[model samples]
Target: MTETRKTVWGVLSTANIAVNQVIPALQKSERLVVGAIASRDEDRATAVARRLGIARAYGDYDALLDDPEIDIVYNPLPNHLHVPWTLRALEAGKHVLCEKPLALSAAEATTLIETSKRTGKNVREAFMIRDHPQWLRARELVQGGALGEVRAIHVSFCYDNRDPANVRNQLDIGGGALFDIGCYAVAVGRFIFACEPERVVAEVDRDPDFGTDRLTSAIMVFPGGRRLVFTCATQLVRSQDVQIIGTTGRVSIAVPFNQSPDREARLLMDDGTVLKGGDPAVETFGPVDQYLLQAEAFSELCVSGSVDPYGLQDAVRNMSVIDALWSSEETRGWADVRQD
Candidate 1:
C-alpha cells in the first residue's frame, strides 16, 4: 500500500474568512493541510496559528511565499490586495486559491490570468457556491429542462453592517454591496444561464459616511431575452433567496448562499398544479461543508496541473458583468457587458 501525500497550503492572512471558515474547512480535507499562516502583525499570526493548529507562522507574507515546503497559497486578503499578492504568489511558484471577486475590475483581473500563464501555476477565484451540491443540482435542473423554458432568475441578498472600522465599510479597498455580495448574483446567473448577459442596468445608493454602496439593484439581459434581476445591500435586514422562473414551472432555493454545513438544504419546485396554497415538491440535500468541497477541488487541480472549468477566464467574464453594472449606475442606462 502506498501513502498518499497531502498538498500543503499556506494562508496569506488571518482574514476572518480564512481563519473562521476556509482554514477550518481545509483542515477537514484529507488531501490538503494548512502548513503555515502569515500576517503583517507577527503576534496575531502566531496566535492564529496556535489556535488553528497551523505548523508555522510568518510575520510577513513574502516569507511564507518563499517557503518551498508550501505547495499552494490560499489568499483571503482584502479586495485591493487580491491581484498584487496573488501575482506575487504565482511568481514565487505556488498555485493560489484567491478570495472572491478576484479583482477590483476586469482590467485588474487580467493580470492574474497573465501571471498564472507565465508561472505555469493554477489560480482560481474562490466562489465556493459553485462547488456546493445544491447549486450543482440547481444547475442540473436548469440544464435538464426541469423548469421548462427557464427565462428569468431573481435574487435578493442582504445584511446590515455599519461598523466604521470593518473592512467591508471601507471605500478605497473595493468595499461595497456590489463587490461584496452582488458579485455572487452575477456569478450564479452566469452559472445557471450558461452564458453571459448582453447588457445590464443598475441603480446604486452610497452610504453618506462610508462612501460605499449600501444598496444596489441590477437587471441583466441574457441571450434569448432571458433576464436576471437581483438586489444586494449592506445596510438592510439579513436575508437571501433565489428563484428560477420558467414558462411552466419555478425552482426556489431555500438557502441559496451561506448555507449551513450542519443542516439539510432544500429546494422547492412548483409545477403550477397546486394554485391554492399546496406544498411544492421539495428537494433536500444532506449537510455538507461547501468550503471543504472547494478546497479539495482546488487541491486536485494543484496536483494535476489542470485548469478549473471556472478558472481565470470565467472570473474575468464575471467581473466584466460587474463592470457593466457599475457603468450602468454611472450612466443611468443600459451598458453592454464585455464578453472577452
Candidate 2:
C-alpha cells in the first residue's frame, strides 16, 4: 500500500512497559509518531510526556482515545482492563494494538472480536515476538517439517521479582504468572504448531500472600498426536528457551522469547551439532526492534484495511487455550479446548 503519511499513535497508559519499551520502539519506526500519552494523574502524564518527548499529555485515558487526530491506540494496560479500554478506543474511531493476551478469557476475546467488527476498526494483540526475524526463521523450520512430524515442544520463560506494589503481584488487577509471562509460552506453542491445542493439563503454584499464581506448568495436546509442555515463573532465575523434538530430528532455540535484536539467536540442529562437532547454526537479526516492526505492520494494516492474519481470532483462540489451562489447574486433569 502507498503511505500518505505516518500513523499517529496515542498511548492509553503511563505503564512502565509503554514508557520503557513499546513507546520507545514505536518512535523508532518512520511510519509511526507518538501523538499523545495519558494517565489518570495530570502531573504524572505531563512528566512522562516531557520525558518521552511526546506531543500531548492527558490526565485520563478518554482524552487520548477521543483525539480525532489519533489514528491508532496502543494500549498497555493491566490484563483485565485490556478489553474494556480496547473497546473504548475502537468506539472512539481508532484502530487498536493492545498488549498480549488481549483479554482475560476466551469470552472476553470473542467480545473484542465482535466489537471491532461493529466499530469497523482493526484491533490486534501486541505479540511483538511474532514479527521478529529469528522467530520467523524458527516458524519456517518447524512448519517446514525439518524433523518430520512434531512430537513434542518444550518452552519456558521465567523471572524473579517480589515487588509488593507492582500490579503483577495484585490478584485483583489480573496479577499472575500465567497471565504475564505464561502468555508468551502459550503463544509460542500455538505459533509453532500452526494449530490450536485440543486439550490441556496444567498445574499452578499460587502465592499465598498475593493470592496469585507464582509458577505454572502445562501440557497441551494438539491434533495428530502432538504435545506441548511449557512452564513460566515470576520467582525464578531469569531464563527462556524453546526446544522442538520431531520424529526425524530436533530444533532448539537458545533465545526464544524475550530477545534483543542486537543479540545473536541460535537455531540448533541435532544432526549438524552432534555429528559435525560444530557450533549451532546461528541466525543473527537486524538491530531492528520487534516492537517497531509490529508498529509498522499495524500501520500498514490501518492504511490498507486488509484483514489482519492473526488479530482477534488468534487472540480468541490463544485465550481459549489459556482458559483450558486454567481450568485444568482446578480439575487436576485434562480440559478440552473448544475449537468451535
Candidate 3:
C-alpha cells in the first residue's frame, strides 16, 4: 500500500492566530503540511518558519502564492485584508481557508463566492467550531428532537483589552467587539438553526478613545420564531457561554467559542424537571483540536473536490446578519437581513 500525498499549505502571515493556534494545528494534521510562511518582513517570516519547522519563508505574500508546491493557503490576516488576500490566493491557483468573519460585510464576501466560481478554486471561512465534536453533539440533540423545538439561543462572550495598538481597537480596519468576538455569536446561531435570520436589531457602545465598539448586543429573528440574543464585549472580564433553549429542554455550553484543546469538552442538557435544572445530564467529549479538524477537512475538500455546500455561501449569509446588526445600530430599529 502507498501513503497518500498530503496537501501543502502556505500560511499568509505570522499573525497571532497563525503562530499560536492555527499553524500548530496544521502541523499536527496528517493530511496537511506547512510548506511555507510569509510576512512583510523577510526576517520575521524566516524566523517564524524556522521556529515552526517550515521549509520556506517568503518576504512577501505573493511569493508564497507563487510556490508551485503550495496547494492551499491558510489566511489569518486582519479582518479588512481577508477578501483581497483570499482573492489573490485563489487567482494564484491555491485553495484558501480564511479566518472568521470572512469579510467586513455581506457584499464584500460575495466577491469571494463569485471569484471561487471563476477561478475554480475553493475558499472557506475558518469557522472551526462547526467541526468540533461537542458542537456536533449539540446540533444533533437539537435536530434529533432532544431539545424539542429549539426556540432560542443566548450567547455572551467578552474579554479585557485596552491596548492602543491592538488590531481589535482600530475602527477603520474593521475592529470592534462585533467583528472580533460577536461573529462567533452570530455564526453559531446560524449553525445550530441551519438557516438564515430574517431580521436583526442591535445596540452598540463605542469606546470614547478608540472609537470602536467596546460592547454590542443584538437579537436575530430566525424562521418559525426562533431567535438568537447575544452580547459581546472587548473591555470586560473575560468570559464566554452559550445556552440553547427549547420548548421541552435546553443545553448549556460553558465554554462555547474557545474550548481548550488539551481538556475534555462537556455540555449540559436539562429537561426542566430538576429545580433550576440542577441535575442536567452531562455529555462529554474527549480532547480534540478543532483547528486540526478544520485543516484536515479542507485538505480533503481540496483533494476530492467535495463541496461543503456551506462554504463561501454560508460566509455571505453570516455576514448578512452582521451587516444588519450594524445597520440596526444606526437606525435604532430592526433591520431586515439582506438575503441576496
Model number with the top lDDT: 1
Worst 10 residues of 3 by lDDT: 1-10
For model 2, the stretches where C-alpha displacement exceeds 4 angstroms are: 272-278
Preferred candidate (lDDT higher): 1 or 2: 1
Superposed Cα RMSD, model 1: 1.6
Q: Please give the distance, in angstroms, between residue 127's alpha carbon in candidate 2 and its true position after superposition.
A: 0.8
- Model 3 per-residue lDDT at 58: 96
Total backbone clashes of candidate 3, pairs 3 or more residues apart or in separate chains: 0
Predicted structure 1: clash tally: 0
TM-score of each: 0.98, 0.96, 0.97
lDDT of 2 by residue, 222-283 (tens): 88888989899888999998888888878888777666756665677774456676665555
Q: For residues 139-200, could you state the per-residue lDDT of candidate 3 as single tens digits?
A: 99999999899999999999999998999999988899999999999999988999889999
Of 1 and 2, which scores higher on TM-score? 1
Model 1 quality (TM-score): 0.98
Candidate achieving the largest TM-score: 1
